[model samples]
Target: MSGDHFHVHGPHDHAVEHAGHGGDDFASQIAVMTAILATVGALFSYQGGATQNDAMLHKNQAAILKTEAANQWAYYQSKGNKQNMAELGAVLTSDEHRNKFEDDVARYKAEKEEIKKKAEALEEKVKAEDELSEASMHVHHRWAQAMTAIQIAISLAAITLLTRKKWLKYGAWGTAAFGAALAALAIAHI
Candidate 1:
């Protein structure tokens, strides 16, 4: 009976010590994970801000292009009006005035063609800029998603630390992996 009691107590004490060690190990792991999470979170946040800034820059460029295109169209309209006046003058005037008005009409038509080409090119540029803005916005969205996951993972880590649950730590790691994946996708967009 004495031998059996010692044996039981020995195993019990060993189990307790092992349990204590497990907790300590998990605590250290959580500390390391928390640090990693903080670093990744900061990086994701910076990326999100950069992508947002890029989107805004593209949008501003598109707006400027659109404004310039509008100015060019207005100039084209003025040229059209001048061409019409010249055509009317040609019909109502004498031969000397008619020749001059015809020449003026031709010049105005050529200038209108040039202006049309420029305006169309500007429209294309605006479209390209808008597309860039959309792409940047998409990257920003990915970064936002990553940030969300990272934040959740960080919160879970805190919970794991408080509760001393190894399963919760595993769950936190899973969430952190998801966040990292999202960040990778966002970076790959470049």
Candidate 2:
């Protein structure tokens, strides 16, 4: 040992020595368990966020299409330059004007059809969005269930190391109850 508190790597990796019932085995186990839990939680959370975002984007697209439909309907009804006659229920005053008005009304009708199609498409997109969000919610529920189990497992390990009070005896029953509830929720979604 250095007298001035100099640090040194312990015997070709201290972690290897700690993976058992002696030396720092408990410390090594804690470190490995912590890393595993962190990775799983992060993966689950990312998936949940991505699915939720997809749902929101679809809702926004639907709203935009609805607005466009309203705008087209309004534009097709304005006066002066004609085309509004059919929509306004006003017959033309002469044959020439009537023929031109018929053409104009036909064009606007076609444009309105295009807008109607877009709105219908938007409705389908929104429905798909809803389904995606619901699926994400299901994933989130599963993550929560897994988290509860992980927490109990970690706690039991800690208590066993600290107090030697038969960790499973304290942790198992609560773990089962929560696990069953989570399983029920997951099955309900199915």
Candidate 3:
């Protein structure tokens, strides 16, 4: 026989070797499934981060608007104080000064009205932004749930490989399906 000649194994040995290779194939399939699950989990993580960032940005904007509204209210208060001081000065002075202070008071009142309107409008804007932030946070929560499911599925897949349990692989599939459903809901913003 040539050095490169093939040796044919007995039927029983062949069957045993085939069974061993079958186990290896099963392990490889589980590894592939775990990798795919990890990829999906990574995508969900990105979406979760993005939604969280959006919520934070909207909250920040609302805070800024509230701060500006507070500043406007403060300005309105200052105007009110100045008007009162002017009125008091007029009482302590002459008729001409009284007329001038009356004009000043009217101007301050008008300006205060304008400021109040602006502050109220800003409050409305803040409310709207807060609603947006809440919505984004809701989406983020969904994505977070999806991430958790995906992670669980991946862990199950690893356990399946370790224990050579077919049932565990099925459980991994079930969890992966659940994760996909959550991810879909998140994408729909529901």
Q: Candidate 2: where is the Cα deviation over 4 Å?
A: 1-92, 167-190
Candidate 3: which pairs clash? none
Number of colliding residue pairs in each model? 0, 2, 0
| Residue 5 Cα positional deviation in candidate 2, in Å, after optimal superposition | 27
Which stretches in model 1 have alpha-carbon errors above 4 Å?
1-23
Kindly give the stretch of ten consecutive residues in candidate 1 with the minimal lDDT sum.
Answer: 1-10
Ranking by TM-score: 1, 3, 2
Q: What CA RMSD would candidate 1 show?
A: 7.6
| Candidate 3: tens digits of C-alpha lDDT, residues 31-92 | 89998999999999999999999999999999999999999999989999998998788789
Candidate with maximal TM-score: 1
Consecutive 10-residue window with the lowest summed lDDT within model 3: 17-26
Task: Give one digit per residue, the lDDT tens place, for model 2 in 50-147.
Answer: 64565566556656655765665455444223446563543735655666667767877677667556656655665665666666566556656655
lDDT values for all models: 0.94, 0.58, 0.94
User: Candidate 2 — worst ten consecutive residues by lDDT sum?
Assistant: 73-82
Superposition-based RMSD of candidate 2 using all C-alpha atoms, in angstroms: 7.6
Q: Estimate the TM-score for candidate 3.
A: 0.84
